[model samples]
Every structure is written in structure tokens, then in C-alpha cells.
Target chain A: MEPGSEREVLTLALGIAIAVVSVVKRHVFRGLPRARRLGIAGASMLVAWTATVLEHLVFFEVLDTVEHLAYFGAALALTSWIVSVPRGFAEPRGPG
Target chain B: MNEALQIAASLVLLVGLVLTPRARTLSVPARVAVAVLFGALFVQQVLDVLERHRVAWADPVGDAIAGAVPFLWGGLLLLMVDRFHTRRLSAQRAQTDSLIDELPAAVAVLDAGARVVRTSAGWRQLFPSAPLDVPLSESVGPLPEALAAALRRTLADELRGAGDAERVPGEDRWWSWVVSSWQDADASGAIVMIQDVTSRVHRETDRESTQRLAIVGELAAGVAHDMNNLLTVLQLHVESMRRRSGSANEASLRSMEEAVQLASEMTHGVLRLAKPGEDEGRAQVALASLVGDTVRLVRSTLLRKYELVLTSTGRPATLDGSATRLQQMLLNLIVNARDAMPEGGRIDVSVVATEDEAQIRVSDRGPGIAPELLPRIFTPFFTTKGAAGTGLGLSVVRGVAEEHGGRIEVSSEPGEGTTFTITLPVGSHARVPQRRAS
Candidate 1:
């Protein structure tokens, strides 16, 4: 098989496996800590995205790999903010 | 394709190994075994990656890689199957161990070879320090021949799938046996689960006894009610007779009145047995103060020989219940603690808080309730204190707790001392407390 085709196949399989894993996590990790679950999910998505970026850089070499990496880095930052931002930030201080 | 198959097979093996069970909590050896399996799979992945990229491989490196690939693949396959088998065996052992551990009855298992395979933890209560895998007869040596025969027959019938055999009850212990046949890849075996069943069967018997006591309590209440009514009528009639007779028979009238009063007192005793005092209402009662008060109330019973210590987190914890009922509950616990230490030891009352509940634990440094009796301690009217105890104390405490949306549990070993825990909802009435007034 062509290296490019095999790489594409591997990437696809990894994506499918990750999607299945995320669904399994939703079903199985019901009792687990929410923060831990989010961490695992975020890490898995980042890893899958990194793999995709590496595959494209190796084969197509169209866009810079660093740009894709930076995009995932931003995604991670967004995930952190989404998880940690307090709902009651605008509430008044104590005793007032 | 071959490389992909190897990878797929490796993935399957890795998944299987990760899921194996250790008999105890996850052990070091088991974790190491899992890590080694992962390492082998990783090496295989690296080899496939190297070959795919056309990396310059030295002759030795190529041969080594090729040799290691199949070896690692084969090793992982064997290891996965091995781990699966081990996990199955461990599970069976765990099931057997927990069966013996938790069940208050003595249990023993016999294999197809009629060898003793598993025995319940309760076995030691009867035959202490007995060796495992010895012949059933040798272990049952202390028992009578007839009892031994019955036990063996039960074990045999269990192996044959003739349903579990029920052995004749022992003079000293209660015995029940369940046998099952199993065929593993390794060997065919019979698993005999021997249970002392003494406590369970005894609890059943105690239940019957409690039923009888309840009947008796009902009868006593009926008789007392009737007698109280008669005495009330008699006392009135005697007073009238004395009034009419005046000086003619004052002493006889006095005697009649005294007899009526005595009968009235007797009726009170009967009533105490038939219907324990009932209270209604929910109030926040501090546990520390309650324990202190109970200690004071039972001060004479302690007789300076035993110390009643009220240990608390001092958080001013409160439970919603009738203070009177709380006092009665504490009094029963204190009295029980005092009685437990006839030779005398310290009784510690610990009040602790859980996330959503308040826990009051009464622990005694006395000969704890025997393990056999631990489960039955909460059953109504089942007391080791014989005729002296009404056996209604714990039952009453439990009833009061349940009424307040709480529960009472006891944990004890023969020598390790007993802890009676009363857990009540943290705040009063997230909903209404169920209470009945008399």
C-alpha cells in the first residue's frame, strides 16, 4: 500500500476509535470526577488533532504543522476556560 | 497486513490484560505484569513503524526485530489468556472468600476429589486453627460420628448436583451446606459452600421467640388493663364500704385498699413490658449533652468501677427527635454499656458528623458481642442478657431512629469490642419526621 494511503487510513481509524472511546467514556465513567473526565477527553482530542497535523505535514506539506499545533493549543486554552470559569463571578462580596 | 494483524492482536491482548483482577486490592506484581505486557506491545509497534519507514536496520537489528515481533505477539497472547484464567480463578476465590468472610455461618467446599477446597471464615469459631485442604473428616474430628457422616453426605450430594444437602443441626452449632459442580479447562471440581448457618438459623429461631414475646406482651397488656379496671372498681367499692361501716371494719377496708394499690403497681410493671413508653415531636437535641446526661442517669449502675466518657467533636451537633425519647435511647445504650463491663472497663461515646448526617457511636471496651450474634443484635427481644433483659432496648432505639429518618447499626467481634452506631439526618426535617403519639 502507498505510505500516504496507509497514513490516511491510520488517521481515519484513530479518529473513529477516539470517537468510540469518547462515547464509551460518557457511558462508563458516569461516577468519575467531572474534572478528571474533562481532562481525559481534552487530552484525547489534542492527541488526535496532533496526529492529524503530523500526518498532513508528512504527506501534503501544504500548511505549516506549527499552525495546526497552535490551533490545538488554543483549543486547549478554550477548554480550560470553559471548565473553570465561575458562574458567580459577578456576585457581591461577603457581608455587604 | 501482517503488521496490522499483529497490531490488532496486540491491542486485544493489551485490553484483556488491563482487565485482570488481583485477589486482594491491586497488587504490585499484577501492575508490573500489566506494564511488561504494554512494553512488549510497544516494542512491536516500534518495529512495525521502523519497517514501514524503511529505516536502516543492521542485520542483527532486523533479525532481532523479526524474532521479537512473533515472540512478543505470542507472549502477549499467552499472557492475556493466562490473565483471563487467573482472573476467573481469583474471582472464584474472592466469591468463596467473601462468602466465608461475610456470612456468619461456617462454610467448607469440597472439590471433585472430595478434598476441602474452601471454608467460610466462621469455621474457626467452631474449630479454631483448622488447616486448609485436610480431609473433611479430619477437620470435623471434634464433631460426633453421626454429625460427621451427615456433613460428608451433604458434601457428596452437593458434588453430584443432587441439590445442596441439609445436615442435621449440630449440638453446638447450626450447619447448612450448598454444593455446586464446575468443570474448568484444567479440571472438573465440586465446590461445597459450608455455612455455619448458626447465627442465621439462630436469628430465625430468635425471630420465633420474639414473636412469642410479642404475644406474651400483648397478653400481659390485656391482663393488666383488665386488672387495673377491676382494681379501680374494687378500691372505690372498698372506700364506700369503709364509709358505710365507719368504725365496724376500718382495718379490713384499709387492707383492701392496700391490696388494690399493690395490684395497680403490678399492672404498671406489666404495662412497661407490654407497651414501652412512646413519645412524639421533633426537637434539636445536642448529642454530647445527651450522652453526659445518660451517664449521670446511670451513675449508680457504673458504681465507680467503670468510666463513662462522652467524647465529641463539640460542634453542638443536633438530631431532631423527642428529647425524652432520646434520653430513653441513650439510657438503654448506657445501661447496656454498663452491663457489658461487669468486670468493668471504659465506655466511650463518640459523636461524629458525616457529610449529610450525625453519627453517635457507643463503643464499649468490654467482651464484645460474639461475631455470631452481631447480626442478630438489632432483632427485637433477642438478648444474651436472658430474663434480666427485655431485649427491646436496641429495637426501641432503632425504631426511634427510623422514625426520625435515621438508622442504627452494630459492628463487633468477640474480643475487638462492639460499636453501635446511630446515624441521623443532619438537619431536622428536610421533610417531615414520621412520629406516632400514644
Candidate 2:
């Protein structure tokens, strides 16, 4: 296969694997704050995008870093606050 | 800077959407509209990011956050559904608790492990010592083995559905218990209900006993009447024979007299037993002769395996009771002793007259009563001998004893044997009679 084609396939495969794992471990993620988990997912995605950005991997800027952090932070914070519930564990005596 | 401003705008919009008033109370269409509005804002934030930032920041960091907004909305919807479920479950639990608390019967909910979870007010009142989360077996006092076994079976069943009514044995009370399965989508357990059924059971038992006693009384009265007629005929024949012999056969005449007297006593005894409560005929009863006569009658009819022994320490162990009734009581005891030792065992009938009481003890070597069953031995219609027993023998003996201001006591051990003692006030009846040479 071609080098670019292989990289695309690899990226696609990695994304699919991570997505599958995230679905399975949804409970673990639910325990985490939604904002924090979003931040992690966004950071991971950034790393992956940066890998594709070999040509664009020149340097970092303050405006760029803050801007990137803002969107991820708000999304995750909204998600976490919205969801957070638990199920059960217990009993009763005789019928009345 | 443009990306940052867009992110800030998205934050403000997300907060505004979440804090929206009456989201839950809104119509489905309104909820949909609100969700759509939030979606549009999220899309707008991503679009602004793409417009301002390079693909490096936009696709990865910016768009990923924007994409997670829909998921956050999904999570919020799940939270709302979860709250509804919790509210419904709590309402059901409260209703069940209220229903059970107001019930007349004591009810308990047992978990999978047979541990008590929730209990009704009646249950708490009835068995105050039992507390929640304790195993039922541990909380309950010692129950009849059969009942305990049944309760265990109920707990094991997936849909426990069983009920039983049983006497408390030593006590006069009776209780009916029912076990049923209690389960919902979330929880599963056994619901046990206990009702005091003393009055109901007693009413049923009394009806049966009264019916049987009436039948028995009818039969006994007929027999007694026939015996009286026969005795009168015999008396006439003896008188004729006596007149013809002219006092020559004195011994034979005396023997006939004794036989006639014994028959008369038997007739009277039958009549007394036939009557429900006839306490008029009271006299100084010659307990020894009564016992001796009963023994003779029993020996003639008894199985060959039984060896009957009669011991009379004080010959005229009389009591201020009807001689016929005393004889009936003695005969009944002897008969019971004979019945007990079916495999040919020793039966001792002892009449020991003390200063205050005439104590007659009838003991037998046989398979004795069970300790658990011992307390119920005197209960009417409660018998181990299913079809063959009327379960009235002991009850009758107790009644007769109590009628004469006396009591019957029994001591027994399984496989060892049983002994029953009847104590009647000797009083003035202990006087020795003038004896004639035989």
C-alpha cells in the first residue's frame, strides 16, 4: 500500500479502537467529571491531529493554546454537570 | 483570539440551555425545540472555530469539544429518565410500606438469604425482638419443626406461595402463616403474613368435637339402658334361685350378689359418661374393688402379650366420688395401658391410699409419647393414631378427674414408656369397710 494510505488506515483503525474501548468503559468515564473527560478526549484528539500535522508542527502560541483549551473545557464541564446518577442496593421486612 | 471568543460564546450558551426554566415540565415539542437551539449553538461554535483557527486546532481540540455537546445533552436526558424511575420506585415502596403497616396480620419481607428486610407494624408489635436485616430463623423463636421446614421451603421458592395454620402447642393460641413472593423490576423478596387464628381454629375444633361427643353419648346411653335391663333380669333370676335354694348355697348366692352389684356399677358408669355434665351421684367409692373388677374384665379381653399387675397397698382406697365413675376411670386407664403396649409389655396398676388422697397410677412399657407431642396429648382430636383413634380417651380421663376435684399427671419418655397418675381426695372415703370371710 502507499505510505499516506497506510497512515490514513492506521488513523482510522486507532480511532475505531479507541471509540470501541470508550463505549465499553462508559461507566468508568461516567464516574469522571464530563468536563475533565472531554478535556482528555480533546487532548488525545489534538495529539493525534498533531501527528498528522508533521508539516504544520512548527511551534505553539499562547492564543492558540488558550483558544483550544476553552472549547474542550466548556463542553466537558456542561456534560459532567448534566449527568451523574447511581442505581441501587437494599430491602424490606414482612408484608403489611 | 477568534476561537477563544467563540469558545466563550459556546460556554455561555451551554449554561443558558442547561438552566432553562421548566425543561422537565415542558411539552415534548418544546423540549425538542430547546435541544435544537442548543445543537445550533454548538454547531455555530464549531463553525466559528473552523473559520478562525487552522485545521491543527479546529478539527482536533475545537470541533471535538463541540461534538461532545450533543453527548452531554444525551447524558442530561438519561439523568432525567433516571430521576423519573427513582421517583416511581420510591412511591411504590412508600405505598407498600403503608399498606403493610396497616394490616391486621404481622407481615415481614424476607430477602433472598431469608433475612428480614422490612416488617409491618404488626410484625414489630408481635415479635418485638426481631429487627430488620436479621435472618428470620434467628429472629423467630423455636417453632414446630414442620412449620420451620415449611418456612425454609417458602424462602427457597422463586414465587413463594404457601400457608399453614398450626397450634402453638404449649400455649392456647394458634397462628396461621402465609408466605408469598414480593418482587418488582428492581427488588425481590418473600412477604410473610402471620394471623392469630385461635378463635377460628377453636370454633372449628369445637364444632367437630361436639358432633363426635353427641354421637358417642347416644351410643353410650343406648348401651347403658340395655345393660340396666339385663341387670334387672339377672337380679330377678338370682332372687328366684335364692328363694328356691333356701340359703343352702350361701356362697353361690353371695357370688351372684357381687356379680349383680358389679353389673349395676357398670350400667351406672355408662350412664354417667353418656351424660355431658352430671355431678349429682357422689358417694364413698371403693376404689380397690372397682380397680380389681376392671382388671379382671381387662385381663379376660386383653391380648396375650400384656402382663397386667395390680398392686393395692391400702385395700379400701375410697374417695368421695361416684363408685361407677371411679370404675369407669380405672377401666379407661387400664384400656389405655393395654393399648399402649401393643407388643406385649408390662402394665402396673397401683392404688396407693394416702391420708389426703387416693393416688392410682397406671404405667406401661411401650413406645412413649414424643416430648414435643407430650404437651398436646390431652388436646381433643389430636392423636398420633390417625384413623384408629377418636383422640378422646385422655380428654375424657382428664374431665372425669377434674369433675371429682382431682387431677391426672403423666410422665413419659420416648422408647422408655409412659406413666399416668390420678389423684383424688381420699377424705372420709379412706374408711375401711367391715370385711366378711369368703
Question: What DockQ, between 0 and 1, does each candidate earn?
Answer: 0.01, 0.03
* Candidate 2 residue lDDT tens string, B1-438: 546656775675576466543344433543554455455546657665675646554444433443454444344434444444455566667877788778766988888777888888888888888867878867765554555666677666654544456766567667777777766776677777777777688668867877887898789889888989998999899889988999899899888887998778767766766764544456677777778887887888787888999999964666666665566677777887777877788999998887778888999988988897787778776666777777777877776777677889999988888999998877663433211121
Model 2 chain B worst lDDT run, 10 consecutive residues: B429-438
* Candidate 1 per-residue C-alpha lDDT over A1-96 given as tens digits, one digit per residue, 9 for 90 to 100: 433334434434554554456456554333222335333433443453444345554753333333233323323332332233233211222333
Question: In candidate 2, what are the lDDT values of residues A8-77, reduced to their tens digit?
Answer: 3444455445556556756644433233544354344434333333323344464345434544454454
Q: What docking class should model 2 receive? A: incorrect
Give the TM-scores of the predictions, in the order they appear. 0.41, 0.53
Indicate the worst ten consecutive residues by lDDT in candidate 1 chain B: B19-28
Question: Ten-residue segment with the worst summed lDDT in candidate 1 chain A?
Answer: A85-94
What is the C-alpha local distance difference test score of each model?
0.58, 0.65
Residue B377 deviation, candidate 2, in Å?
3.4
Report how far residue B35 has shifted in candidate 1, in Å.
Answer: 57
- Residue-level lDDT for B198 in candidate 2: 75
